[model samples]
Target chain A: MKQRLSTLMVAAVMTASFAAHAQQPAKKAPPPAKAAAPAKKEGITAEFEKFREVLEEDNPAELFEAKGEDIWKNKKGPGGATMAQCDLGLGAGVVKGAYVQMPRWFADVGQVMDAERRIVHCMVKYLGYKEEDIRKQPFSNDQRTPDHVSVITYVAAQSRNLKIAAPQKHAKEIEAYRIGKEIFAYRAGPYDFSCATCHGDDGKRIRTQDLPNLRKPAEAVKAYQGWPGYRMTGGFMLTQQWRMNDCFRQQRFPEPTYLSDSITALLAYMTVTANGQVYKGPGIKR
Target chain B: MADPMKIRAQMKGDTAEIRVLMSHAMETGQRKDNAGATVPAHFIQAITVDVGGKRVIQGQTSTSVSRNPVFGFKVKGAKVGDKVVIHWEDNKGDKRTDEAVIAA
Candidate 1:
């Protein structure tokens, strides 16, 4: 009888331990099949990564960077001087590391200018390159010559690997930053869209494309490097001017004048808000 | 605009990929009326594609082509590593030409 009781107790204990183990979910068990469906349906991140990989090779911006270098050095404007002599806020004649410091205030220029606007000033003053003409012919047939797009690429390329250091030293710089933040958040368009509409948050997309939150540092850096990119959709190589122009049109807003202060302000916002990020341009885009 | 337009092309196997980025506003003509007069008809008339030196695709397009238009397509037998050339012209005698390389 004693032996039988001991056997029974051992059996019961084993059963209880087994039951407890089953009750505690196994850590390595395949996740319930039902949970997989919802995860698969919300496949935003995976899609974005695939699309980005497609653009990894042979970015067309290399061409623009090459041309921009020529425009920077070659003397062509009415002034018959090379833009190499102009100041990009790294002091006169310094092109290195100037791009990442832009959207900052310049006491001499008396306004906050982004990379493109500053390039325009240099072209006009030092190179005698007329602003009107350059703006009108954003893309020149003379692929051999440096056009506005090429110059932008060149300047932006120079700042590659440099951190965004848009100076907040001047009062005007602060003012521009404030205005830029408002503009970014301000929504008024046919679609009631703002820059925030597409880029205000994380994990948003247009079709298979990823839309980065401009408010985030990593995302901003990833995007800021791609302006002045060659858009496969627009055959002509385009600069920031063309990019902003298209954005406004897509928003169904009236055309902003080329190189207008409003656009400049927007650029200021994009650059400064992208503080500590590097500038990479003439990137190839879809 | 000395040369009205130009196109160059190439082709590969099993795909007829082409790239066309044209220079035209592709104005929809439905835009506002100065004096309420409707804007006249203005649009791209045709686009031709050549792959590896053979005409593969020809399309008739309208003003709906975006400004500085661009297009991509795949066709039979166009292989990877082929060069695709495209040409486009408008009713107004404006034209443009561009090319791209094919990849699988």
Candidate 2:
């Protein structure tokens, strides 16, 4: 798989190099200084768009979504209940159109929650599973119990195509969004790294992937919707909570309790900031 | 498990460039050694990058990740000549850290 991807990468880069060379004027007439700036800007955008197109064909995230669906409908947990009955904030057992409205306030829960937390509630309340039981199992060993990996993939897939509409109607929901926005900008760690460190700007990439600016709508919506994806690096489906926890680990801050308020807040910010943008995740990622 | 992980970091423009070489088998638990016994899964559970003691990026990883996963990303506002440090911990509780100076 890796070899095929490398070959494709080389082919793409070579193609771009050839295309770029071809586009140059044969006479090499120097354009006006004013024209040069806009040309450069347009070229950069075009290049990035092309790069995104190349990656779209080979996203590895599909495999995880497939597996996640299997896990979701499969009966598990102490009660042997499938997740089909779990409510994702659209109503009990309602899977479709639930994700976009999430990070919203649910009076039943009395606190703001994101997709992951809501999944946990279904596992605990409806399925009669203990929270500790799920957390204690190692990622590798745990093959059951509404496993965070599979359920997240399943839930996120359900949200695919729905526009982000994280509601802020309730006071607590609004508070969560406020806290989430603050968390996104807060910088505290041994290295003083904040989410802004990598995501504050446009037109930057880590290695091959572009880092989306979280402060912006179009980019944030597109990027935020792509998680709960099957990460090529992790080799399994992951939810946003897992994504956020991993981000904290990389940030060198103590692990944010998985599915904690901090993560919920972050999701709130992302969902709200991403309002009206469609979700297309359970996506493949490198 | 006791081996020291080698870490190197550099400041490249507004981002802190980091590379970590950890001593781990990163066992996928899907592999069997020649002895036919399944190798238990072992991999880095977390990695963190700190610039001048501020948290930047944190990641949760697993055996599916590449061995000695060499991850790189930039932290905005990290200037040249700043100290960039990287630390990693595996499920086994093994820890390693390394630091490098940012270049102008």
Q: Which candidate wins on TM-score?
A: 1
What ranges in model 2 sit over 4 Å off?
Answer: A1-63, A74-84, A137-146, B1-104
**Candidate 1: residue A71 lDDT (0-100):** 71
The DockQ scores of all candidates, in the order shown, are 0.03, 0.02
Compute the lDDT of residue A207 as modeled in candidate 2: 59
Across B2-63, the per-residue lDDT of candidate 1 in tens digits comes to 12221212343443434333445455677655477765666678777666566766778775
User: Would you list the C-alpha lDDT of every candidate in the order shown?
Assistant: 0.63, 0.65
Residue by residue across A1-286, what tens digits does model 2's lDDT show?
A: 3322111111111111112334434434255743767535454454555544443443334434445566567756676676776767777778777877888787876888887788777778766768887777514222322355666666676777878788888899889989988998989999898888877888776655678898888988766866765443434445677667877888898987767899899889888988988887766554
Question: What is the per-residue lDDT of model 2 for residues B1-104, given as tens digits with 9 covering 90 to 100?
Answer: 33444444565544455444444446677987667888788777887766665666667777655543334354555666667677778887877776777666
Sorted into a CAPRI-style docking class, model 1 comes out as incorrect
* lDDT, model 2, position B9: 53
What proportion of the real contacts between chains A and B does each prediction keep? 0.03, 0.00
Determine which window of 10 residues in candidate 1 chain A has minimal summed lDDT. A7-16
TM-score result, candidate 1:
0.60
